[model samples]
Target: MNINNAYVIAKKEFGFNIKNHWFLLSSVIFCFLNFIIIYFGEIISGDYSQTDIRSLSLSIIHLQMYLIPLFSFILSYDAILSERESGVLDLILSYRVTLLEVMFGKLLGNCIVFTISFLLGFLPVFLYLYFLGIKFLVLFKFVLVSIWLSFIFNSFALYVSNSSKDRTFVILLSIFIWLFFIFVYDIIFTFFVVLFYGSISNYFLNFLLFFNPAEMFRLISIFYFIPNDITDLFGINVSSFNNFYVCLSMFIWVVFVFFSFLFFYFEKK
Candidate 1:
């Protein structure tokens, strides 16, 4: 594991993403959405005399649940397979770097791109919230959770990228996985709860929630930031587990999928 080789590859990948406009495009989209959210929040506050920080944060969380997964998938779905198909993987492997180092470098590069875009997009909103007298702690927590959510999905997408040699198949699979996790999972959970009702234990439901990063993120935000009424409105029973458990579960999900990606990636090599 030549750390210097890895760093060089990571820097190159990160620079390529910026030069190719993916970073700029994502930042612009997210910034526009963040501005709109703040504008709407301002309008609501005008009528209500108060807008809770939690409300704004929850709104962002819900949007993040949908957008982050899609963006992550689109950004990384071709990270590895495209390299292989274009013979870039072979060229890179001829260098001083090991396969593991290359994988780690690519992962790091994507992470850097994502983190920069997220900060650029959300910094203005954070400032606006601060001007509105929202506490720093709440805003900071939201940023942390949002970043972790992106990381989780990016790892999943990279796994998809590494798994398939077919770019078209990888693209389709990425979209399907995003749709399943972001939309279908919630619908299925709701259906089961509605149908079975008391037959399903709350623990079992929370267990299911823990498995889907998107739902887990929503539940975490609901418990941490949003009011109880919102959960009640959706018939969601807030889990008894602490935020630490949810964070750990998400971290574990990222690590598990990432290593699985690395294992398959090297196996093919």
Candidate 2:
């Protein structure tokens, strides 16, 4: 909780990683890939100018749902693991920094880079959609939801980095996190629907959908940009949309994951 110590650690983390050639190169590649996806998504829609912004944005989000989370994972999975493995953790703590300071500092540094890279990668898409008739507010909301998803994933990566000792195990858990959120979660919900078979109401199921950060990003986009009487996501029906709930869900995910990292893994096992 010492702000000065945290700042010192954060500065060091930021300074060291920002110069990493692989990090910079991958960031550039991610941004380029994002642009390519949208550029083609518009052109392939048959007429770039006449394409619906909502549909295009949704498509971008759908595909990005895969890319961004994985990118965030790569950014931080080794944040703590490498330090501990190399005995740098003690060196860091020896400088009058507490474990909380180390954790917060590292998380803050990674998030700064994540935020910048995430926004820059999506910059082309934002401008392209705005010129094609999407309102600023809607695009802003879309950006916010996407950013929240990235933050959630980054926290999970950091949490795994904080808790796990073996680098190989961390990689496996990161892959599992991506798979569970993007794919396995829907399957689980579908199985539940089949098992319940009309016994469970869609409202309850929809409300439960808010629990997953990935789903929340897609749901918020669908709710705000493509509103309808009812929206179905992989057999999970969403009957209502509340701004409070949406914000609360994302807030909870970010807080829960960070605290989980702090409380559950403050000291190495």
lDDT of each: 0.78, 0.76
Q: Tens-digit lDDT track for model 1 on 1-269? A: 67788798889889989999888888889889877775697697786466667667777778777878788887788888889999998899987567777777877888789888888878887787777776787678777777888888887787788777887889899989998998898899889889888887777877878788888777766665654643473475654667677668877887786677567756866
Alpha-carbon TM-score of each model against the true structure: 0.88, 0.89
In Å, residue 69's CA in model 1 sits off its true spot by 1.4
Best by TM-score: 2
What's the true lDDT of residue 240 in model 2?
58
Q: Which lDDT value does model 1 have at 241? A: 62
* RMSD of each candidate relative to the true structure: 2.6, 2.4
Off by over 4 Å in 1: 40-55, 227-234
Candidate 2 per-residue C-alpha lDDT over 39-153 given as tens digits, one digit per residue, 9 for 90 to 100: 7876788785577665666777777778778888998889889999999998988877777787778877777777677677677667877887778898888878777777778
lDDT of 2: 0.76
**Clash statistics: count for each candidate:** 0, 0
